[model samples]
Target: MKKSDLALGIFLLSAIIFMIIPMPAALLDILLALNISIALIILLNALFSQEALNMSSFPSILLFTTLFRISLNISSTKLILTTGAPGNVVTTFGNFVGGGDLIVGIIVYIVLIIIQFIVINKGSERVAEVTARFTLDAMPGKQMAIDADLNTGAITDVQARERREKIQEESSFFGAMDGATKYVKGDATAGLVITFINFIGGIAIGMFRQGLGFNEALDRYTILTIGDGLVSQIPSLMISLATGILVTKVSKEADMGDILVKQLFSIPKVLYMVGAAMIFLGITTPLNVVVFSAYGLLFIISGRVIANRIEIAGIEEEVNTDESSADEIRRPENVTSLLQVDPIELEFGYGIIPLADTNQGGDLLDRVVMIRRQVALELGCVVPMIRLRDNIQLKPNQYVIKIKGTPVSEGEILFDHYMAMNPGYVEEEITGIPTFEPSFHLPAIWITESQRERAESLGYTVVDPPSIIATHLTEVIRNNLGELLTRQDVQNLINNVQESNSTLISELIPKLLGIGEVQKVLQNLLKEGISIRDLITILETLADFASTTRDTDVLTEYVRQSLKRAISNKYFPDSETTSVVTLDPKIEQEIMGSVKQTEQGTYLTLDPEKTQDIIHSVGEEVSKLENLGKNPIIITSPIVRMYFKKLTSDYYKDLIVISYNEIESDVELQSVGMVTA
Candidate 1:
């Protein structure tokens, strides 16, 4: 065992022994001094600690000290009654410190007990109880705040976990303290009872056993009893004061002394007013002029010194700030910071600032938080934290969305206007400024609030400026989710899955496919706008087919077929015969025949002219489906699906490509056109 642990064990065992055994006078004196020293140390530590949690073990310490002190009180009582003396420490305290008068000593001891029991102990107990109650009641809110920060990417998982742990510690500390305080109260009561018994029992024993008269007995035992009470009560008072200090501490991030000094004495004006008031009182009142004048002048001088120090500190702070800026320029380590880049950033100009600022009644931040949740649910991927910044170079209304520190999309919005787009049935064109929807590039118009109601009545879809930005941002993130799916992100998903399906994760990860390979498969699925939310099915499929091939594209195809139910529900509406274009059997054969396999992966080795012819034919068939007001979905044989999708990916970014195996058998589909080259 550790020496400290063994020492504590011995100390507790000694307390138990002190209660039952007849301790020697010298040993009693030594233990009494030790008790006082411990209480003083606890008081000072509690007074200076930055926060209550710094002394989380104080509740248990309170219990130990109370028991030890009570045992010493009993030991001292026994010595005083039977031996007619306790020790030099107690006798000296009875004679010198108590003024050698029985009434004076009794009065002093009574005041200490009253102060501890009625004032300090009572207040500490109440504060501890309330603090525990408040901490427990606020736990849910604190938990929610942590979750909000985690969701918005303001804090990492580790940081959130640490915050949660700190909160739990605080709750437990206060709750235990609420009960521990009762030990202090009970100790005080027990000491009062012990003191009474010592006086009564000592006087009776002296008169009857030692044959001393009432006056001599009263005088002798009264002083010793009062001395013993003072010895015990002083340490108890210190502990009570310590408990009060701990429960009342407010600041946890700085030194308690510093915080108190800053709050009480930092302002020179308050000190100056006090100095003037003291001087006025000294002159006008019947107070001692010399003593009051000395205090007044001291205060005024201190105030002036404090004012000058404040000014000097401010000057020094400014100088340090300037020096730091210059040092940053001179420092080579600055380059390291510049190399870091945000995964996603949104830069806007001044006009749209109100939409992003909550103080200006903007819900842009709330919308951004929701966008992350929306994407997580829709795509089963975490979007990197989106940083919002303002750029003075752009027009007031313009904003840019960047991925990996490079601008990919920019839009301009009228802060006071709403965006109205025709759903194609609205014939009444509103008089407004012409614009295009930022997310889809469909023709839209900027309309004022006055026109919004009329536009909606005319079957035109109207959206506010904040909604427009959020929608555009969501679309950009969704489209680029594949690129955003980092290896770390893949590992996070696997860890989450491992929490429940540990066997599947351990077998598939590192055994068959590595994180990078799994990331590639997930990225491929995301690129095709597939949801990997059902990770179990995805992992199970990968583990099944992984031994045959580690090629990510082929694994992704298998995973997609496993997720066919979700895909069918997503693309093909229930009980509806969806119109889709089909790959011509002849063209599928040609594409399969042109396929080339290498160690790296497979690629289409079709003739350049033939590829162009096939691309043109795919576009023609896609347009036919588009004109039919249907999504441009192309169904192909399972084997040729991935290659065909890759062949057309460059030409059509939003094209929906599926295979025959991925479609549900219950779902109906009609092929309106065929891609043939």
Candidate 2:
């Protein structure tokens, strides 16, 4: 065992030994003195320390010391009643405390008891209780503040973690102290009981066994008992004072002594007024002229000195401020920090600020947090922190969502109004300001609070401003998640999978595929609105086919076939036949015929006229499905699926294309249209 651990264990063990074993006078003296020293050390430490967390172990220390002190009390009581003389420390303490009179010593002990019990212990207990409760109550606000700082780029993840840990430590410290204060109070009570027992027991033993008269016994044992009581209570009093100082301390900065002095005496005006009052009292009243007038003169002089110092300090501060400002203007700009960009940003105007501010009862910031979580759960990827900024150039209630510092979408709202969109079944039109829904550009109307209930009753979809922004932001993130997936993110995903299936990641990465290659395949999946949360299955599929071809596109195709069950469930439900389109075999063969391969990858070199004709036919087929109110899905041979998706992506952003190999047999399908050129 380490030396410190062994020493602490032995220290605790000694407390038990003290209660069990008999001790000589010399050893008892040394132990009593040591106990006094321990109490003094605790008092001084608590008095000077800056933060309450600095004494986080104080609760455990309180328990240990209380047990030890009670043991010492037991020892001293034994010697006082049995031997009538514990040690010179006790004998000398008795004489000094009694002042050769038992009554005086008794009165002094009673006062000490009152001060330690009713004043210090009681007050400390209440303060610790209230402080612990307050700390617990304020914890959530503090955590939210930390998260705000993190989201705004004011602090990094590491710094946020440290701050959160500090908050936890503080709450725990105060809570433990709340319960620990009772130990100090109980110790005082125990001291009172032990002291009474010693005095009564000592008097009886002295009179009966030592053959002393009643008065003589009273004089000897009363003084001795009082001495023992004083010895124990003085240390307990110091400890009690320490507890009060620690729990009552409010600030976490600098020494307690420094804060107390500055806060109490730093105001020169108060000092000057007090000095004037002293002078007035000395001159006007019949008070002692020398004593009171001397005090007033001293205060006036001190005030003058302090005021002069303050003036000089203010002038120096002004000079320093001027110098700092000049230096700041002359220095070269630090633009490195400005070079970085947020992955996702929501910039809004001042009129919308109230929606993001907690004090204004706005839950926009909370919605943003939920958006990140929702995206993660739906897409199986952790979204980067969305930074919210306020832009002044925009109109009131206008906001924009940006990807990598470039605005991609913008919206405006009327305060205290809800957006109502017709779901094609709401025949009765509500009278309101016409606008387009920012998310999908569908026609919507802004309705006031009174119109909201009626609009909902009329089968119109009603949403508040925050919900609109949150939905729009969610769509933007879903669209851009492919571009936002970095190699580092891929590595993190690999590490997560490696925790369970190490061999698969090890064989796939840096062998048949690099991180960027895996990132591309994952991005490809994400770009098509596929949830990559089933990472193990995805990696296992890659591991199976990655060796034959390092081409991520080809590998992604194979992985898709492996996840065909999920894809089938997503697009075609077994309960009903899904309407879809099928590519003509002749055009599929023609597409394959034009395909050319190079060192880079495969590309189609079909005639532009032919490509245009095929695209037009596909668009006609897609419109037919749209007219039928069915999703535009086209099935092709497994070899031509990826190329067909690439060709149609520019024309249709939300179209879904699947291969015959990517569908399950149990899924019912009906071809309502065909694409041909």
Best-matching candidate per lDDT: 1
Backbone clash pairs for candidate 2 read none
CA deviation > 4 Å runs, candidate 2: 1-330
Number of the predicted model whose TM-score against the real structure is largest:
1
Q: What are the Cα lDDT values of the candidates?
A: 0.92, 0.91
Which stretches of candidate 1 lie above 4 Å from their native place?
1-289
Q: What's the residue-level lDDT of 143 in candidate 1?
A: 97
Candidate 1 at 106: error in angstroms?
Answer: 12
Worst 10 residues of 2 by lDDT: 328-337
Deviation (Å) of 589 in candidate 2: 1.3
Q: Which digits, one per residue and each the tens of the lDDT, describe model 1 over residues 514-594?
A: 999988999999988999999899999999999999988988989989999999999986798999999889889999999
